[model samples]
Target: MTLYHFGNCVALVYVPYYLAYKHSGLSEYGAFWKCVQAGMIYMFTQLIKMMVLATFFPDNVEEFGSYLIGDFFKYTVDIADLVGLHFVLDGIPGKGHSKVLTAGIGWATAEVILSRALLLWVGARGAEFDWIYIQKCLESNILLVQHIATATLIWLRSRHNLNNNLKTVVTILLVLSCYKSLLFESLIHILKLGTWLGLVVKGAFTLAYGLFSLSIYAGMAELMGIY
Candidate 1:
């Protein structure tokens, strides 16, 4: 197997154990299990969405550059996926935001493995040394971090009082999550610049996204008193 496949291969095993360890000692193990369930649900939701849309829309890989049409589906899938996490977390009981963390871990861990890793292994086999893959990995990590924060923020949404400010904040976060998801999945189409230039552009976007994610995560952290 190629190095890309190997990395994804190792991750398939490593990520589960790693996330399990991270989920350990912090919350009920059941929360992690629920997270897994939610992840499965989210995956199926996307698959169904794709299956239905395939009747009308072009295959995303082939027509990803058709910004207007492609993005509608992208936004639909991403929003549904992220918002579905909100309902998933809300279904679970117990407070203190550990459940939120568990849910995020579950969601991120599942996506990184099932979607990112597997897709890269299958489609990017020959391009083991490609800069795009590195960019893809970076975007995945950023989104993973954002997913954790999204869970916490969504969890926070209900716990907080009914106020305009809180509503606005939650709205901002939800929008941010959807926005990031679209960009990460589709930005490659826009990165027509050569390798080095693309990497530079990707790097800049990733850095900005990381900082934005950190600020949101920090806000959630403060709410949880992690600081």
Candidate 2:
């Protein structure tokens, strides 16, 4: 039954992605190759981010201020993800919507494979069942929402026709999206929240961010007259 368990976990992890690609008109756009390209860029960007973190933010930090400094620099490195997303957006050949969808899905999928798949493969298939694997699957879904919203915000930020005020709002939201996990980590540490509570907070924040991004997108289109 371990295999069956594994299958269920896999389905929970991947089915949303498949439905998103199929139902969001990415299938009609034939964006598979573009998604692949974006995934490749994601991998490369992560590799560079890791290298930078390792080289600059070595783990010997002991002082509280050092920890703060280290974390600050590390978060700065995460901004590279936006640079990578921009590359993915510019590199893909399609309209804005297709490019955003392809880049976001591809980036999120690559993240799941690289970060979570092996843990599930080993843990979910083990004889002892763990709710952690299921939790991980739910986290994967959250990541999808966050990535897609961030992608839309980034695309919106790129539009020169968007007024400075809207662009500034998008930029602030984009930064918040990018630093989401760090903010959550800080909150969890400060409040000493349990794992389940932390997950609940993350889910709520992601939902709010997604809705806010959609609202901004609608406002942007209405104002600029183009996506």
Candidate 3:
């Protein structure tokens, strides 16, 4: 899509979100401090994830050992992330949904910060980012919110699901875990292949994932009669 088209899409989504924010007085959730705490958890878990990946999943991208091997490791890291998020945020003080959103923002913020920092280190700013970089920024925000959506599922399970039905919680976490694992696995394929098809697939999957995340958020909001 063109930059203008994407901007319109973002605006369309933003308007209602802004309206809800105003009506709910959403700031009472203390998103900022909670985000800081969530960011810290993300950073810590990210470091551990990297260490584990490097130690076990190392450089399979260079060799042809990438497909099965990389996927296995990707699943490992995804599970680790789930464990970390559960460890830090489960049964905490705030409302389940609000806290999950802040935690997601915090996690997404760390990701964007570290990613752009690496780009700057490589002088990527010298490249044509006027349009591409803006798109990346927007894409990253979608992803960050996706993180929140995943956390929300997990949080809702912890708060209400298992207490209601074990089978339902298992199904939800499993589906979301596969969703998370697929994204990471696709990313590896993109990096290893470095082909146009790979790039296109990666971008396509990212957008699809973003829409899925937003849909879940909207579903949850409606389900709870929050809006």
Highest TM-score scorer: 2
- The residue pairs that clash in candidate 2, if any, are none
Task: Write down the lDDT of every candidate, Cα atoms only.
Answer: 0.62, 0.86, 0.57
Mind giving the per-residue lDDT tens digits that candidate 1 earns over 130-202?
5465556655655565666677667656665435676686678667666654664456557555655655555
Q: What is the TM-score of each candidate against the true structure?
A: 0.66, 0.93, 0.63
Candidate 2 on 58-159: residue-level lDDT in tens?
786554266756566678788889999988898877676787889899899999888888998889999998888888999999999999888888888888
State, as a TM-score between 0 and 1, how close model 2 is to the true structure.
Answer: 0.93
- C-alpha RMSD by candidate, in order: 5.0, 1.7, 6.5
Q: Which pairs clash in model 1?
A: none
Give the candidate number with the greatest lDDT: 2
What shift in Å separates residue 98 of candidate 3 from its native position after superposition?
1.8
Query: For model 3, how does the per-residue alpha-carbon lDDT over 65-140 read when each residue is reduced to its tens digit?
Result: 6566566556657666676677657634666556666665556666666765454334333433344444444555
Error of 3 at 159 (Å): 3.4
Using lDDT as the yardstick, the better of models 2 and 3 is 2
